[model samples]
Structures are given as C-alpha cells and as structure tokens.
Target chain A: MAETKTYREALREAMVQEMERDENVILMGEDIGVYGGTHLITDGLIDDWGPKRVMDTPISENGFTGAAVGMAMMGMRPIVEMMTWNFSFLAADQIIQHAAKLRYFSGGQVQIPLVIRGPNGGGVQLSAQHTHSLENFYGHFPGLKVVAPVTPNDVKGMMITAVRDPNPVIFLEAGALYGTKGEVEDGDNAVPFGKARIACEGDDVTLIAYGRQVNLCLRVADTLEEEDGVSAEVIDLRSIRPFDEDAIVASVEKTHRAVAVQEQWRWFGVASEVAAIIQDRAFDYLDAPVERVSGAEVPAPYARNLELAAFPSDKQVANAARRVLYMEEK
Target chain B: MPAENGNGENGGAEARGEGSVATSADRLVDLYREMVTIRRFEEACQRGFRQGKIGGYLHVYTGQEAVAVGFLDSFKEGDRVITAYRDHPHALLLGSDPKNVMAELYGRGSGIVKGKGGSMHLFDVERGMMGGYGIVGGHIPIGVGIAYALKYHETENICQLFLGDGAMSQGAFHEAANLAGLWGKDGQCPCLFIVENNQYGMGTSVERTTAMTDLAAKFDAYGIEHEKVDGMDIEAVLEAAERLTEQVRETGKPYAVEALTYRTAPHGAADFFEKYRSKEEIEEWRQRDPIGILENKLLDSDAADEEKLEEIKGEAKELIDEAVKFADESEQPPIEELYTDVYSGEDEYTGEA
Candidate 1:
C-alpha cells in the first residue's frame, strides 16, 4: 500500500518510523527541536520522542557532528540535520576525516551508523554561501555512502536503509522540491543503496541525474518525446558512492547514446563520472559521444533569474539529449 | 571541589592534607611498577623510532606518566578513556596488552586494530579505551558525545576525556565544552575532562597560545566546574581523579581537571632541535619528573628499599623488552587487510576489492 506524501513528510516518516522501531535512533541538528527544524522536516517530532531523541544542537557543526560520530560509535543511530549542505563544510573535518574514516581506521572495531542529511543545490535563491551540490565532493571518498534522492518514495525508503546501514551515509535531499508530492510506500519501504532508480524508461537516449536534477531530466524526457519524437530514458542515480555502474552501462547499451545532466559545475561533477563510466564500460555500444549538461560555472546567485540561469535547464537537457540523438539543435 | 594548585609547580603531599606515606605499601609499589613500565615502554618506542623500526610520527608519554596512571586508576568498568596522539600510557593503564600496543607501533598484523591505526590512532574499545586520535582537538567533542551516551543509557559510567593544554585553544574543545555544560544541566553529560598541561603544544608554549593561561579556569565559560592538580605528583592526580570521576559519575555532570605537568621529551621523535625550550628548563622539569617524584615518595615512606625498586625497574624492562621482541617478530598486516574494515558486514570494502 502507498499514500501520497510531501518529500519533507516522507523524510520525517522515515526518521519517525526508524526511531520508533529502534530506540537507538535519534535526531540532532540546529533548530530541529523547539524551533521545529529550519526546514520543519523534524517539526513536532520532539513532542513525540522528547528532547533526548530529537535534540537541538548549537551552531557548532564540527562539535555536534563529531559528537554524533561518537554516539554512533557507542551504538546509537544518530541522524544529523545539516540545515543545508552548504554549512556542512564547517564540519567537513569531522565528516571527511573522522566519520568517514573512523571505522576503517579502527580496523572495523566500531560501526558508525550515522546519517547527515540536508537540502542540497541551489533553487530557493539562498545565494553562494547557502547553496552547494556536494554529491560528487562527498562521493569522492570511499568509506562514505552518498545518496541524493529526488522522489518522496526514494527519500523515505533510502533514509530507512541509511539509518539501518552500519556505515555513515550522506543523505542529500532535493531542497527545492521538499513540498513536491508523490506516492510513498506505506511502511518498511527500505530502498537499498548503490542502485539507480529508473524514473522513466525509453530507448532513444539515456538521461542520467540525481536529486533535483532528476526532476529536470524527467521534464526533459517528456519534452524530448513530445517535441522531437525522441524517447529518452531517465536514470536517477540515487546512490553516488556505491554507484550503479551496471545500470548505466545497461541503459547506454540499449539506448546507444547518453546525456549526463547535473545542477553542479561541469568539472569533477556527477555528470563527469557518468560520462566516464559510460565510456569505460559501454564504449563499443555508443552511437555518439556522451553529452554532459551541467550548471553554469558560477556560485549560486540570490536573484531568482540568475539562480535559474546558474542551474541546468530543461531546454539545456533537452538539447543535450538531441545532440546525443544526432537531431536538430532546437 | 578539589583545591586548584599553582600552575607548573609540584603540589606537595601536604597540599591535599595527605602524608607522603601511602596507606598500602603493596599498592604504592604496584603503581610505581606500572609507571616504570610505561616509562620503559616509551623509551623503547624512542629507540624503535631511532632504529627505523617504527614508522609515522611518534609522541611518547614520558614525563607525564602520573597523570594517566593516577587518573586511570579511577577508571570503572563501564567508563571510557579517550586521548590525543600521546596515548600509549592510557592504553596500557586500561589493560590493553603491551605486546599488541608495541606491535601496533611496529605496524604488525598482531598489533591492536590490526596495525591500521599507528601510534597516533590506537583503539581498544573492549577495554574502554575508545581511541587515540591523531588530530589534536578532534577527539574532544567525541569524548563529550561518549559521555552523553553513557548518561543517555542511564548508566553511572563516565568518559575520561584527556587532552593537551594546546587543544584548549581549538574551537572543538570550547564548543564541546559548551555542549557538555548544556547537556550537564540535566545531568546528561558525565564527562571528566583531563587537561594534561604539558606546557608546550608541539613547540609553542600554552602561555604563547592563549592569553588566559589557566586552562582549567577556561571551563568556567562552559559552566563546567574545574580545578588544577600538580600533574607531576601521582597522589595529587589520584586524589583529584578519584573525587572527580565519582562526582561526574554520580552527578552525571561534566568536570575538568587541568594537570599541570611538563613533557620532558621532545614533541615528536624527529623533533631533535629543542629550540622551543632551553636544556635548563627541561632539566628543571625533569628534577620533578613524575616517576622521580613517585620514586622519592616511595623511598621516603619505606614502601620499598633501593634494591626492591631496582627489581621493579628490572621487571618493567623485561616486560617492555618482551613486548618489543614480540613486535619485532610479528608479521605485517595481510595485503587483504587493506580492503577490510572500511565498513561493517558483507561488502565491507568498496571499489576494486
């Protein structure tokens, strides 16, 4: 059974269900308790679980995040809210150095069942300091499990899986689409990591993305089918670190061409990895070179027009698909 | 509250209203033996580093033995102990096998943590030695969290968080201290912050690092009660540790103890240039060396004769020698170990492996 839910609700439900299912699961973040969370994803949760489980931490990212790592090491499942992925840079040392490496450094003596989730990428016009797409940045590390879920269903399912997983997970949410509604699974809809979700399947060309960019690719897939009679397959790479190379290779083998899209800079982004993977694994099946549609190389701007311009557009993804399909520029 | 003593000076036995004579001669001898073992173990490490038998940066707990030995004496079964890179003694005191510790330093598979964490990063979770972090201030918040969890679990156990005077300047320390104080209001943070004031952080002295030289008083900003102890004196440290650990455990609140001691050795094995401090300063601190102070007290109290003390030293030497031999003979970690322990369970490693 499934019910319609907002992305925010699905995320909250995952945490609530996990917390209720396992007493060890706790939530800690800035403004997550009494203030009802900066995004209200954990709103009203403190009333149910109380302050011990839904904790409001100080603005010290490194301190609280490191504390979460400690808690996880001591057998607590801590789900930390980053407010937004941009602020996670402050706690990068803890996340990258300790949380990501402690288990390996300790010779697997400790398991860090920890999750750090927050809004990612630019869409609400929060500007440069407040906006970042960190899937590739975090996915670069080996020990971390990075997931960027676009749909409410995947958000809930992956979060459950993340909370249950023994390793640390970097949960990147579609910040701009928090209120977007979708049919989410009823209960225990645990989605495994390292698997890509086939959002829409077609045969002409493969469009690859994750997070909010997945929505854009879906829109682009529709436009490509309606305007150019090109059937585009959208592959949502829900998991980044334990990436689904076989899925991309399989899709590319069938489509014979691919367009990798991302809302991050073209250099060293997830799209680049997709392009690399397609070339490395399915080079013989390619009808043309893989196309990459990426955001403009600029820090996110506060002005809505500039912010929209900074991110990859539906028209851009559609044109990239057209290029990979060897069709008209329009 | 224990009386805060003057900084960088030995707090005499009379300061705590205790005599030099220990109540139990056997216990004093045992403590003396443990301290000697640590000192000998550290001296062997220096030799290993010089002989190229040990790799990576090596920080030994040479002159600051009393602080760990004394404080760890108060360690309860469920309690946890965490510290920075200079963590050999904490592991030893927590009952981690000396051979495994030495083998870890030797980078052998038989080493604790399978030689993954070297001198800077030792972990014996079963013994309540949570970890020995390489980063100076990185482990402060972690220790605070461990304490918070202990209280969260409704246990009377506490976390003995040991850090250097240098780490007090880090934002992690202050932030964690604030959290400790905040959580402690409801008696949820039973963290015992043991500030091992070894004077210098690497090469810079604490005086040069922070305007407020009283490291213990800094905890006042976080509402955590703190005091200083003559770190060179084992009895003074033991007195503070016993009182503070119990207080933290019972109250479920955080406490701080700044043990004013000095590291008579260089900051690292390769730090041969003692340009930071003069030989005179080192010699002065050495006169009040923790081991020497304990030895003098034991001799004065008639706990043991010179011959008996020599026997203890000889035994410690033999023990450390055996540890070194075991480390020397132990094999390197299997190549497959490189891929293991990245994550738990099946598919433990990612990537090519």
Candidate 2:
C-alpha cells in the first residue's frame, strides 16, 4: 500500500488529501491544470481532481489574484500558486495590501486562509527574470505567515497545515528541490507555522537556514563533522515571518557561535534580518561575531558556473564555519 | 430590475428571489442628497487644503461619489467596507461622523484614525471602514481576505472593496481575483470588487496603463460576473450595486462592478489637472456632476423645492464648519500614542529589556 516518493510528490499528496477532506480547498495558477505545472509538482492532479478544483488561469495576475482575495474573503481555503516567486511580485498588491490588511482593518472580522505557493530562489540558471528569493518581501508583511519548508516531510505537513490554518500563509518551495526525493510521513499530518526544525543537532556551531538551503547546511554540517571535527547544529528556519527565533536562540545558547546561511544575497537580506534578531535576543551568549554565509550580491546569471557561484554552497558554508571556528584564514 | 442579474442570486438563477425591489422617490432623493453632500465636502476640503487649513495629502473623489454611496446603500449596518487612500467620500458615505472625518484631515486627535492617518490613511475600524491605504493597489487582497473571515463567522454579510483602475493592474488583484472566482463558483465567497475606474492612475490613463479598455471584461478571465457602470449617475450605479451586492450577501458568491467615472480633480491635489487631461474635459464631466444630476432629478420630480436643496447644502456646510472647529480645537495625537495599535501586543511576550 505504501510507496517511495519525491518531495513534490509528498506535497501533491498533501494537497490531494486536504482537498479530498475539505471541499472548500481549491488550487489556481497558470499551467497548473493541462500543463501539469512548469515543474511536475502538480502532475496528474488535474486528471484526478478535474478543472473545477485544480484550476488553471489566464495570464492575468491582477484579475485572478484579486479574485483569489475575494474568494478567501468569502471563506474558501484557496491555495494560489505563482509559477515562480518572481511572478508573485506582479501580484504584490493583492498579497501585501489586500491579504495582509483585511483582518486588522476589519477589526478581526475576517481571516484570509489563502496560501500562495511556488518555487523560490535561484540555481537553475533561469536568469534574473525568473530567479528571486521573496522570503524577505513576504516576511516583511504582518497579516501573512511566510513558510519555507526544506524537507519532503515539512513540505507535506506545513502545506496541509497552511491550507487548514485560519490566516493567509505564503508556502515557499525551492525550485531546486521540487523533484528531490526523501522519506515523508503519510496522510493528514501538518506542521505548525513559526516553528523551526532541527534537521541535525550538534553543539560546536549553529548553522541556520530554511527551504532548500537547510539540506545544503546539513551537507556542510556532515562535511564539517567528518573532516574538521566541528559538529554544526543545523536549524531550519521554516516560517520566515513569525520566525522560530526561540529555537535559534536556544541553539545559540548552547553552541555560542552562529552562522546564518541562505541562498539570497548578504546585503539587507533575509539572513541579515535573522542575524540581527539573534544578536539582539542572544547578544551576550555569542562567543564571536554572528557570522553570515549568503550568496554574492549580484543578479543570478544564466550560465551554470556563475549561477552556482552566485548562490551559497556547502563549501562556502564550510569556509564560513572554518572562519568562525578559526580553522582557516578568511 | 431582474433579481438574478449580474451576481445577485444564489443557486443559479433559480435558488433566489427576484433581483431588486423598486424604491420610492424619497429613498432616491436621500441617496441624491448623500452624493451632493460628498461633492460639496470635497470641494470645501480642496479649498481648505489650498488655504492652509488642512495640512495633508487630500484625495478628493469628486466624480466617483455614486460608487461608494450606491454600493454602501446595499450594505446593512454590520457589513464592512475598505478602500485605497482616496477614502474621504467612502468614509462620508459609510455613515461615519463627517465632523470626525473632516477633523481627521485637519490632524485633530478626535478624527478617524485618531489623526494618525491623514487624508490618504484614514481608518475607522468601528464603522467597518477598514482604512484608506496610501500604497497603490495595496489594500485589495486585505479587503478580500477579511471578507473570507466574515463569511467564516457565518454572518450573512458582504465586504465591499473599492479600488482604482490603477490597483487593478497590481498582481495582488489577479491573485485575489483568482481566489474570489474559484471560491465564488462554489458559493462561499461574499466579496464585491468595485473598481472605481476614475480614468487615471495618477498621471497615466487607463488606455495607457492597461490593455483592456473595458475593465469589466477583465472579470471574464476569472469567471466572475461583472460590468461597467456610469459612476456619475447615482441611480444607475445604485441600481447595479443593489443587484450585485445582494447576490453576494445571499449566495456567498463574489461580484465585480467597474464604476466608470472620471476624476475632475488632479489624481491628488498636488498635480495640475492640465498636465494630463484638458480643462475642457474636466468641464464636460462637471456638467454631468452627480450633484447637478441629482438636483435636476429633484427639480423634475418636485421631491423638494430648490430652497430645500439649498438648505441641505447649507446643512452640509454647517457640518463641515463644525468639523473644522472641532479639529482646530482638538489637540494633535500625542507622540506616545505612536506605539499603540501597531500590533496586538496581548499574547506576544517580546521580553524587551
């Protein structure tokens, strides 16, 4: 009865299960139906669910996005997908202004349980137009719960939870990990927002990240433990908006040194915000300067080599760790 | 008027009552009066802004009065309304104390939003007047999102979201629209998207900014039922809104209404109207001004004498004068109040030093 699956498959299962359980759940995006998604994340879904539920849209961001807000306002749990996080910028008004302000402005009269899910970050050499990390953009908003699930398990769990939660949730999945395979839990299980997961625990230094970067951090942790005898505690930030800073502070209390890592650039980036929070909350607990490991501050290039160099890698994380642990020259 | 017209009925055309109940001339006259009051109020506000009495970015919605008044007439006391920064008319139409609204423009503490938000950022949560947003097309999703909550609460209420043609171009409009369309087809969405297409988005005209000349046609993509209405004509706007809003309230489906109006003033007060539009164009729209049209209707019907119409105008002037006095006398919002209402600090324990 059981079968092995990819991370995207697990997410599909979560959506399928949630949709089946609740008639109110629906999905909408470009090419989500007949096109089966630009990635196979929604493959076979349209065939199973049909057009009414697995709705594809015309190339009109303002119209459909506003319609989604209207739907969420009406009470159906709609999961809206932008093909990429870059496309979401087109609908930023609906996301930030409308979805975020309705509840407070209505004085707690409504909840927009709408989820905008899509691939975020760069590595596929899609170049500047498609590649973007909107974690900070959405994370800056108040009425939204911004989620970045790295694992197949969390992707399933958090998405289901986001669909069921009372507020609007921005479910960000990394493009590079869509087809990546891993073990995942079965039916109906959901992860709560604002809660971080410890992918692999260690005590030497804390490695903080989320989405696809968490796996990269874990790989670096493995490299550090095997080669340099440095055990890195890897933390998945998960929900970026209501961030799980408690877990980060608790880990930093034990590890003393921290390296904030992300696929986005270092300047005024998501990781910088994290580093600031860590410094403010656990300033005295720091054994050294709160170091940051992020991508170079440049537009993501289309070529494979430049694309790889533009984003943070496991080796760069190791180098950051070496610098933090005083194992090598900066 | 047909009950099943536009998006007024639930359960297809069959699951509902007839489209609209005809109204007596008294009710129509009252609506006309409300529109007139809004016209005179904005004209005075403009004069005040120029005279240095009101210090803020005042967005006078001179031509788009009918959209708010006509749409809001369908809403019961408990129903909600939210819009972008050009919100004075909406506040006036939504039964807010006009004095408080005018005072808010004067930066008086007693004003709506407690004078924290000036012309472009008025908020009166008590009246379900969510706010006047400063960001272009920023408040659309939030308005629809709140509508989601209202329906969840099981209240047979509808939330009306009014935005400009400019906001219709934002991606959130599409995202929120897709959501509304899908949820609406299932009969769970109680949102009404009223695009007050006042011809321009600041400096750009709709023809320049968007591909679609008729914004109502934009709804066909989302599969939501909608149309374009003459915003200057109060009767037509009200007739259309009454039908559409009731459908949303009764069936829990969403509707879109594009009230095609033109702004007689500059997008905001700062720009000269001559830069984008011709003075003749403004003159033409002014001749068909909602107030003038209503006044003519009252004269034709003999609902009230010309003297009574003048008295109502005087009454509106007195109200504004009271508001100006109240705002002048009332102190500005104390600086310490800034930290308040930023968030619901109740459950959050930040452990601040």
Candidate 3:
C-alpha cells in the first residue's frame, strides 16, 4: 500500500520509522532540534525523540561528523545532517579518513553505519560556496556507499536501506525537490542499493541520470517522443558506488543508444563513469558513442539566469538524446 | 649516573597530598615493570625499523612510557582508550598482545587489525582500545562521540582520549572539546582528554607551535575543568587518573589532564639529523627521564634493590625479544584480504570480483 507524500515528509518518515524501530538510531545536525532543520527535513522530530536523540550540534562540521563516525563505530546509527552537501567539505577528512576507512583499517573490527544526508546541487541560486553535487567526489572512495534518490518513494525506501546498511551511506537528496510530491510506500519498504530503476521503458534510446536530473531526463523523454518520434528509456541510477553495471548494460543492450546526464561539472563526473562503463561492457551492441550531458565547467553563479545556464536543462538533455538517436538536434 | 645527580632532589610520595587510594609498594613495582617493558618494546621497534623488518613511519613512545602506563592503570572494563600514531604503548598497556602488535608493525596476517593499520592504527576493540589514529586532532571528536554514546546507553564507562601537544592547534580539538564540555553539563559526555605534552610535535616544540605554552589551561575556553601533571612521574599521573576517572564515571562529565612529558628518541626512526635542539638540551632532559626518576624513587623507598631492577629489565628484554621473533616468523596477509573488510555485508567488496 502507498500514499502520496512530499520528498521532505517521506524522508522524515523513513528516519522517524527507523528511529522508532531501533533505539540506536539518532539524528544530529545544526539547527535540527530547536531551530527545526534549515530545510525542515527533520522538523518536529525533537519533540518526538527529545534533544538526546535529535541532537543539535554546533557549527562544527568536522567535529559532529567525526563524532557521528565514532557513534556509528560504537553501534549507534547516527544520521548526521550536513545542512547542505557543500559544507561537507569541512568534514571531508572525517568522512573520508575515518568514516570511510575505519572498518578496513581496523581489519573489520568496526563498522560505521553512518548516514550523512543533506541537499545537493544548486537550484535556488545559493551561489558558489553553498552549492555542490558531490556524488562523484564521495563515490571515488572504496568504503563509502553513495546514493542519490530523486523520488519520494525512493527517498523513503533508500533511507531505510541506508540506515540498516553496516557501512557509511552518503545520501544526496534533491534539495530542489523536497516539496515535490510522489507516491511513497508505507512501512519498511527498503530499497536495496547498487540497483537502477527503469523509470520509463522504451526500445530506441536510453536516458540515464539520478537525483533531480532523473526528472529532467523524464521531461527530455517526453520531448523526444513528441518531437522526433523516438522512444527514450529513462534509467535512474539510484546508487553510484555500488553501481548497477548490469542494469546499464542491459538497458544499453536493448536500446543500443544512451545519453548519460548529471548536474555536476563535465570533468570526472558520474556521467564520465557511466560513459566508460557503457563502452567497456556493451561495446558489442551496434550503437553510437554514449553522450554525456553535464553542467558547464564553472562555479554556480548567484543570478537566476546564470544559475539556470550552469545546470543541465531539458533542451540540453533532449539534444544529447537526439544526437545519440542519430536524429537532428532541435 | 647523570640522572642520579639531576632531578634527584625532587621529593617522592610525600610531595602530593594523600588520597583515599594509597598506592601500595607492590603496585609501584608493577607500574615500574610495565614502564620498563614499554621502553624495551619501543627500543626493539626502533631496531626493527632500522633493519627494514618494520615498514612505514615508526614513532616510538620511548621517554613517554610512564604517561600511558600510569594513566591506563585506572582503565576499567568497557572503558574505551584511543590515541595518536605512537600507539603500541597504549595497546600494550591496555593488554593487547605484544606479539600481535609487533606482528602488525611487521605487516603480518596474524597482526592486530590484520596488518592494515601498521603502527599508526592499532585497534583491539575487545580490550577497549578503540584505535590509534594517524591524523593530529582527528580522533578527538570520535572520542567525544564514544563518550556521548556511553552516556546515551546509560553506562558508567568513559572514553580516555589521548592527543599530542601539536593537536591543540587543530580546529577539531577545540570543536570536540567544546562539544565535550557542552554535553558534560547534562551528564551526557564522559570524555577524559589526556593531552600528552611531550615537549615537541615532530620537530616543533610546544613553545614554538603555540604562544600559549600552557596546553591544559586552553581547555578553559570550553569551560571544562583541567589540571597539569608531571608526566615523567608515574605516581602523579596515577593519582590524577584514579581520582579523575572516578569523578568522570560518577558524574558523566568531561575532564582534561595535561601530562607534561618528553620523547627522548628522534621524532621518527628516519629523523637522525637531531637538528631541532642541541645535544646539551637532550642530555638535560635525559637526566629527568621518567624511567630514571621511577628507579630512584623505588630505590630510595627500599621497594626493591639493584638486583630486582636488573631482573625486571631482563624479563622485559626477553618478552620483547619473543615478540620480535614472532613478528619476524609471521606471514604476510593473503592477497584476497585486500578485497575484504572494505564494507561489512554480503557485498563486502566493491572492487573487481
């Protein structure tokens, strides 16, 4: 059974459910308790769980994030809010040095069941320092599990899976889509990591993305269908590190044409990985080279027009899909 | 001996006020033995590093033996202990098998943490030795978090966080200390910050590193009560450890103790230049060596004679020799182990299948 819920509500419900089920599960972040989360993803949680469980930390990202790593080692499932993914750079040492490598360095003696979640990517013109898409940055580490779920259902379900996983999970939420509503399953509907969800199936060409870019791909799929009479399959790569290579290969094997999309800069982005994987695995299929639709290589500007120009748009994705489909770009 | 002539006038036992727990002669002897064992073990490590038997950066807790030995004496079951890269002494004091510790330095399969951590990251969780972190000030927050969890779980256990004098400059230390103090107010953080002010950080002395040389007083910024102790004196450290550990356990509040000590050996095994300070300065500190002071105290108190001290030294040598032999004989970790332990579940490895 399922009900329609906003991405924020679904995300909060997933954490609340897990916290209720497991006493070890707790939330910690700046302004999460008394101030209600900056994004309100954890709003009203302090009243239910109290200050101990819903901890409000100081503006020390390195300290609290490292503390969460320690708590996770001691068997507490701490979900640390990074306010935004941009601030995570301050705690990158803790996340990369300690949280990621602790289990390996400790010879499997400890497990960091830590979930560091926050809004990622720029949409509301928060400018340079405040905006970032860090999936590729974190996914490069071997010990971390990186996932960016766009849908409310996937947000709720993936969060459940992330909480239960015995490794550190980097949850990249679509900051722009917290108010976006979708069908969310009730109760423990945990979606497993390392699997791709085929958002829309088609036979001609495949459109691949994750986070908010998944919605952009769907929109591009509609435009492609109406304008070029081309069928575009949309694949949401929900997980990045434990990537669904088989799903990508299978989708490419069927459609024979693909366009990898991301809101990150072109250099060393997730799209680059996707393109490399496609060429390595599904080269036998007679299709054109995979096209990568990525953001312009520049820091996000404060102006709305400049910001919109910086990110991947429907037109850019559609043209990329059209180019792969061997059709004229509109 | 130069040590006998220098620092010999410093009074022992009667110097500090008597606490409820009177340290017995037997306990003093035991503490001396442990300190000597650590000294011998560290000396062996230096030899092993020079011979290429032990790889990576080798940081020995040579002259700073008494600090760990004294502080760890109050370690109770379930209390967690964590420290920086110079960690063999902490692990050994917490009862980690010396063979495994030596084997780890040798990069062997049967080593503690399975040869992955080397000298910098020794972890014996079963013995409450959380880990030996490599980064300066990085483990502070983790230690505070462990204390928070201890309180969260409604346990009387506390976490003993060992940091170097250099780490005080890092933002992580200040941030974690603030959190410790904040949480301690509500009886939710039972973290004991033990700053081992061992004179120098690598080659930079504490005075050169910070304008404020008093590292313990720095804790005052976080509102945590703190004190200083002669890290060279085992009795002083033991006295402070027993009383402070009890206070933290009872109140679940964070506390700080700056143990002023020195590393008589070179910063690293490869740091042979000795250019940071003069040879005369080294000689001066050597006269006040912790082991030498403890030996004088034992001799003056009639706790043991020269023969007893020699026997203890001989025993420590034999034990360390055995550990070295075991480490040399141990096997390297299997190739498959490279892919293991990256992640914990069914899909344990993310690399090539």
Note the Cα lDDT for every prediction shown. Answer: 0.90, 0.77, 0.91
| Cα lDDT, model 3, residue B207 | 87
Instruction: Give the C-alpha miss distance for residue A111 in model 1, angstroms.
Output: 0.8
Q: Higher-TM-score candidate among 2 and 3?
A: 3
RMSD of 3: 2.8
- Tell me the DockQ of each model, to 2 decimals: 0.78, 0.18, 0.86
Question: iRMS of each prediction in angstroms?
Answer: 0.9, 5.4, 0.7
Q: Residue by residue across B1-353, what tens digits does model 3's lDDT show?
A: 32222222212333221234566666777888999999999999999998999999999998898789988999999999989899999999999989999999999998999989899999999999999999999999999999999989989899999999999999999999999999999999999999999888898988898999999999999989999988888888889999899999999999999998988999899996378988988888888798898787676665656777788999999999999999999999998888889999886656666
Cα lDDT, model 2, residue A104: 51
Per-residue error for B250 in candidate 3, Å, reads 0.9
Report fnat for all candidates as fractions from 0 to 1: 0.72, 0.25, 0.83
The ten-residue window of minimal lDDT in model 3 chain A covers A321-330
Candidate 3 displacement at residue A217 in angstroms: 0.6
* Chain A TM-score values for every predicted structure, listed in order: 0.99, 0.96, 0.99
Ranking by TM-score: 3, 1, 2
lDDT of 2 by residue, A171-282 (tens): 8997788888877877766787778998899998999998788988989988998898899999999988777879999999999888999888787777888788888899
Candidate 1 residue-wise lDDT, B98-209, digit = tens: 9999999999999998999999888999999999998879999999999999988888899999999999999889889999999999999999999999999999998899
TM-score of each: 0.97, 0.77, 0.97
Residue A113 shift from truth in candidate 1, angstroms: 0.6
Candidate 2 or 3, higher DockQ?
A: 3
Worst 10 residues of 3 chain B by lDDT: B2-11
